[model samples]
Target: MEYITLNNGVKMPIVGTGTNTYGKVNNDYNGALTNEIPELESALELGYRSIDAAIMYRNEHLVGRVLAESTVPREELFITTKVPASEEYVSSKDATRAAIDNSLKNFQTDYLDLFLIHFPIENKEHLKNTWEVFEEYYEAGKLKAIGVSNFEKHHLDELKEFAKVKPAVNQIQINLKQPNKELLAICKEEGITPVAWGPMKAEDHQKEVLNEIGKAYNKTGAQVLLRYQIERGVVVIPKSHNPDNQRANLDLFDFELTTADVEKIENL
Candidate 1:
């Protein structure tokens, strides 16, 4: 897998697996939890090292269990989890600290590769306090890098007013349906990496275009979409339960998109 160097010099995998629905019943985001996650095991076996997890998903312990028990050593893994912007987590500094501590325990790790606020905190004080707690953990070496997810330009502006450390990444939805062009440019200008969550999503017509483009490279439309994102320096976390699809998701390093093909995709 390729890597992107964050502003703080931390290297993050350009491709990762999203675990929002992993270990859930029927692969539903709101489904009941299952005792095991074969998909995650399959991902590990397929050489996926970057894991994108969040507290709101409600399955950290199970995901962590799989990671901790995997044959892959902890050093080779790039684990990223987010803290929600809710009262239970961001109400106070101590509460935030406790939440992170619990996450560390659940993952059975001394340090996480990256940590992020799941959403923007509207209240300035709460946002400040939460960020300060994140900064504390980062300084203490518990969190290698800190960042925000689903943050818009205004929220980033608010963060800059009091932030000593710039955000290392801004995880957002980036697909043909929601190009998010402006925010992506902002991230590029500010030196923050953009992590695309729904990288495989595309309309049928768009998929047709991607498929046509993929034919030349002997790849699938989904692979084409993911390749488009990573080619432009965006990190993608595309998840799937099927082992073949999982293998296809990681089979992105073999091809490159032509400049005209990239423009065609951008215009789509």
Candidate 2:
């Protein structure tokens, strides 16, 4: 695994596993769902040091359970979670306090490597109050770093004006189809690392674009896509239930892409 230093002076894994899921599945506090959902333990076994979960995902306890069984040490791994995407909690300091406490209990960890404001709220004032809680956690050493997710330039601009401590990261969607060029530029300028959520888009089965790229390097379409993002200096989290893909995603370090190959795929 590779590492990058955040503005706040903390090291994070450049490539990692992100446990970001959206659904209203019924499960116990430890995330034992009847549905055949992807298991977090498999990721741990495959050497994923970072786990991204959120209160909204409602699987923090389950994430904690997987970590507990893993051989990895707590300090060696980076864990991040997000607040509810609304002004309701941010407007009330009391609400923010309760939310953070709940998250800690759910994840079963004493400290968080990173925590982010899920997104800009409808009410601007609420954003200020929300950031206040994030700062508080940082000062207390409970949270090593803090950041924002799914924020555009306008959203980041507003936060930067009032942010006492700069954001360390901005998690967003980035893939072959969605390069998100403009937002990425702001992050590079503001000293925040951009972490991409969807690194692979199911192989683009319909498009010959992926197949063409795959042929050049003797790699699969999945490998080609992930390598493309890594070339752009973006941290990606590509999930898989199959063991083959789990191993394939980690096999990127062995090969490098040529300049022309990168340009051609970027056009696609």
Candidate 3:
């Protein structure tokens, strides 16, 4: 798989599987937990090393169990999980610390490749305390990298006010529908990598455009969309339960989009 080096020099797989609904009944975000995640096993077998999970999904332990039981060594996996900005998890520094320790236990690993604040903590104190806990873990070698998700420019500016370590990534919605051009540019300016959460999302017309673009490369529209992001230094975590789609998501290194094609996409 291709990798993107963060500002802190940590290499993250450009293409990873998102586990928001994995191991849940009916694959629903609020569904009951199941005993196992066959899709995760398939992803691992198909060479997917990065796994994006979040505590809000309520299946960390299950996702972690699959990773722990997999044959892939801990070092080869680029595991990323998020901490929610809630009273239960981030009411205080000690609370945040407990949440992180629980996550490590759930993952069955001492270190995580990346950890992110799942959302923008509105309260300055909560945000500061949460970030400090994250920095503490990062300094302690427990978290390889720390970042934020769904952060706007103002939130980023707020983080910059006192952040000892700049955020390594800003995970946001980046697709044809929500191009998020300004945020992307800011990330580039700040040397923070952009990770696309819903990379495959596209309106019907946008999909048509992507389809037409894909025809030239003998790839699917989904492939073209993901390629567009990664070609411009955006990491994409496109989730799919189908084994074929999972394989297709990672089948991105073989082709390159021409400058004209990229321009056309940018225009779209």
Candidate 4:
């Protein structure tokens, strides 16, 4: 697996597994959750070193179980979880601190490689306060890198005004259709690495271009899509339950996309 350095100099796996695929807004972490754990296991077995989760996923316990039993050492794995945007936790600093503690307990790990504000609540003060707590954790070594997710340029600007530690990353929906050039440009200027979630879920029109490009490398459409993002210097987390898909997702480093091919996909 390849890696990209965050602003703080931590090496983050370029590709990882996301746990939101089992359906959001559900709490069946014991039954159906068991089915998804193997996909994470499969990812690890296939050499994926990063695993992304959130408190809202309600499956961190099961994720903890996997970590407890895996033969891999804790230091070799990168675990990330988030604080949700719901009012209950967002409105209270103590609640947010408890939420971080809960995630640590759920993951069965002492520290998280990265922690992010799951979503930007409209209230800038609340968001800034939450980030302040995250900054404290980061300084204390509970969190290695601090960041935000689903934030637009204006939200970042607002947070920056009172931010002592600038965010190291901005996780957002990035694909061919929504390349998010403006937001990405801002992150670049701010020294924040942009992580692309749903990197393979390209639009129908974009898929044609990806499929065409894949033929050159004897790869699949999804592989081409992921490669495109990586070439653009964005980290990606493409989720899959199938073992073959999980393995295939990481097979992006063997080829390169030309400037013309990249432009074709961009224009599509």
Q: Give TM per candidate.
A: 0.99, 0.89, 0.98, 0.94
Give the candidate number with the greatest TM-score: 1
In Å, residue 209's CA in model 1 sits off its true spot by 0.7
User: Which scores higher on TM-score, 1 or 4?
Assistant: 1
User: Which residue pairs in model 3 clash with each other?
Assistant: none
Off-target runs (Cα >4 Å) in candidate 2 are 21-32, 35-38, 202-207
Give me the runs in candidate 1 sitting further than 4 Å from their true place: none
Q: TM-score of the candidate numbered 1?
A: 0.99
lDDT of 2 at 149: 90
lDDT of 1: 0.95
Per-residue lDDT of 93 in model 2: 77
Find the 10 residues in a row with the least total lDDT in model 3.
27-36
- Decoy 4 TM-score against native: 0.94
Worst 10 residues of 1 by lDDT: 193-202
Model 4 stretches with alpha carbons more than 4 Å out: 22-36
Q: Rank the candidates by TM-score, best first.
A: 1, 3, 4, 2
Q: Write the per-residue lDDT of candidate 4 for residues 174-248, one digit (tens) a residue.
A: 987677889988898889999998788777877887888889899998998899889888999998878898889
lDDT of 2 by residue, 105-144 (tens): 8767888898988876757778888888889988998889
TM-score of 3: 0.98
Q: How many residue pairs clash per model?
A: 0, 0, 0, 0
Candidate 3, 100-166: lDDT as tens digits: 9999999999999999999999999999999999999999999999999999999999999999999
